[model samples]
Target: MTEHSEHGTQFVSKKYTSWPAMTEDINGGTLHAAFILAPLAMVMAREGDVPVKIVHLGHRDGTAIVVRKDSPYESFADLRGTEMAIPHRYANQRILIEKLKEDFGFGDDEITLIDFNPPEMPAALEAGQFESYIVGEPFAAKAEVDGFGRVLYFTKDIWPKFISCVLIVTQELIDTDPELVAELVQGISASGKWLDEGDERLMAGVHREGHIPVDPGRGAQVIIPDGFGTSPRMQAAMIASQRQYYNQDPELLKWVLSRPPDRVRYTELALARDEMEEIQRYAERLGFFSRRPVTAEDPFGFDDYCDPSFAESGRRPLPLQPADGQ
Candidate 1:
């Protein structure tokens, strides 16, 4: 592994074109950790026996339901008899759609839901392959910015604090090197706080050199070596990097960021039992737990699969200075 940080731990970033490919690697132990879909993570741990634990969340409420700008679909009622694309059957976006159907007094058969790769959804929608698409950013943002689509609703408007993806680590890593896990959780928390701080910080992150000032008291610091969007050359590099890393478009990313502050959130990410239970309830109702039956009384073990200690530790205030003249 390449040494990417001052700390002894080496980091390797991998990209996957599809979730199943990524999940397969996680199951086979080729990948140690991932930011994975929440419902899929639960299914992996409980049903697929992947022996992983949900440590933290990636982001909240970054999803939307979009329809063609020229289309006459204004309400959920208008979606009847139309086809919609989703990232996957197990995605929370799909669950959100299901919840919409229920709340609107519509049956499952009223609207057709098809599984399509998120990167393809915008082009597919443009070509009239589907009436609408629901997905996480910046794919949904792409359609809107490209002028072919308009938002039907942002998920936050319906499900406050909606969780789509989570940070998951293998049981082996938790057992063998917990300090690393703690450090990772803290870093994620800090990064999320930085992102949610406001536009200035967000723009700095995008336009300036990437580095985390060493917490002198802590003895080691995390470093992002790439200087993205720092200049014309780096801006092009950043765009290419985002495309490779997330299949993301720069315009869409800017659009997502320029929206209301609450369009998507990164703070308040600590894993909560109530939230997990709510997700489980939805997953169960949607028949996502096919390998085994689950219920509120005897649900797939959230207590066993989720470890909030790392997030709890991450939230504790760091020391202001080095202790006793290290």
Candidate 2:
């Protein structure tokens, strides 16, 4: 009953509480497509013998490092010798922590890194089990909303354009139904654009309501009742989608919305060789690629494991501009 047919194609969505379980399903061919940690996906394809390829990205700059608000840790340097938790060893959050250690000139034994489920991190930190934890949002926002954690750094601020997850499909699916894969990529690309643009418009409306000031850098214009002025259909569709996909706790949603426009971005999701190379380099440096040695010339078999054509050719949905005279 998880499968629903749309436009003659059956779509199934599966949720997993842990990356290892999801990765197992992905490797076993139970899941055709998923959004997973970028480094983990690369390791899965190259080291774990899964025939999957990265087609598009999930989002950018959505991860953060959080410490208890009452903790004495004012900076990353203060966390030296303290235990820190990460969702997974293969996660980019782990790589970011390694980078932080390098940047702060800390040794390997300086900070103890533990693997803990992201959802349990906030509670553990509150109980003094760890000094800090880094993971993707909604979780970080959860901590802030509960008034227990304060952000030490948003990945966006430190890594700039940090990619946590990517959309990957099995190679079998790609070879058997290339058109379906193309449709999937294009649909995701368009939706990502739509979400980014709609967020801008929504933020503008929030600004007009005196809730928050619109950032001039984002070029958001003041709009009326619906973020898209005079476009009731667009407004209705956005509302419905939010109700379905983003139906999280009200306080969590509010905390997410109160963040700056660029806290997380959905645009620029197309897979780029340079970005992939960067992740591979970090993964190699961090010893995530244990199955085989990676060389500077070609790491992780990038060309064989990635197909950017789908994302490059994907059509973007046009934003609904405000109509003249209201």
Candidate 3:
């Protein structure tokens, strides 16, 4: 989704479905800003080649740990020496997993860590490849709805007000057009407001009516996984096609609708400076900055990476405008 500022500034936004593509776009100058995972951004920044700074947070507290619905495991304590998968070492999921281990008095060897792409996680779990997988939704939600897994814990339950994704910009963009960056943040914040309202379906995209393929054998009980990673503009049509997947079972619908919204101010999008500091400490603890170690005391001259001044002007409300051709 995109929004225009009253200054007659037009913003065009695009979605990159994968991390590599998103990071490539940011580093290659194809896009000026992005909603990216926080730790990964920190890693890129410390590596010194991808000069991007996190200006605002995109989301928070929307991660979970999932296990097969029929599994005997009950908690982190029950999964001793079991196979576990996380998206990557740089992901917040790994930190939480470590915290889980420490809290439960489990040794590092008690959990066999495996890295799996988010989409592959469900299938891997279903096939018993791993006992549990931790990732961000709608993947976790996808597993539950498909009846293959159930949530063991939500990161929100463990780490209150946890910060995850963030909005970042290339250093060049920040230097060349700070106002434009502010405008973009304002636009995204407004979009978040619309999304937070929760019934407008603006976040869900355009729907078109027609017959969509569903398995005849499953009858009306077929669960189509069409819109899992769909862009907002396409989610309407994608969701429309997958109605049975969402509506066939009231309990599942309740669960899907029950996923909590990320905690965001909506009107003023700014980096959670305190949380970012915590992330920096965790990254260092996890050895992400081993080459150029960033500690709490000597955070390696990284304090300048966070600049909240843009947010000062960026938080201003956008003047409502008519939709195109209205």
Please list the C-alpha lDDT of all candidates, in the order they appear. 0.74, 0.73, 0.65
Question: Against the hidden true structure, what lDDT does model 2 obtain?
Answer: 0.73
Model 3 residue 181 distance off true place after TM-score fit, in angstroms: 0.8
Residue 149 Cα positional deviation in candidate 3, in Å, after optimal superposition: 0.9
What's the ranking of the predictions by lDDT, best on top? Answer: 1, 2, 3
User: Which is the leading candidate under TM-score?
Assistant: 1
Clash counts per candidate, in order, are 0, 0, 1
Put down candidate 2 lDDT per residue, 1-326, tens digits, no spaces: 01111133434445678898998887777787988999988887787656888999988997889999988888899998999999899998998899999999999999999999988888998999989999897788778889998899988899999999999888989889987787778766765666665433332222222334334333223323324332222332233224334445544644553476567777899898898988888988888877777777745567866888887665634333333212
* Tens-digit lDDT track of model 3 for 176-224: 9988888777666665555444232322123223223232221122122
User: How much does candidate 2 score in TM-score?
Assistant: 0.80
TM-score of 1: 0.82
Considering summed lDDT, which 10 consecutive residues are worst modelled in model 3? Answer: 215-224
| Shift of residue 62 alpha carbon in model 2, Å | 0.9
State the displacement of the C-alpha of residue 45, model 2, in Å, after optimal TM-score superposition.
1.1
Better of 1 and 2 by TM-score: 1
List runs of model 2 lying over 4 Å from the truth: 1-10, 199-247, 295-299, 316-326
- Residues 52-138 of candidate 1: C-alpha lDDT, one tens digit per residue: 999999889989899999999988789989999999999888888888898998886999999999889999999999999999987
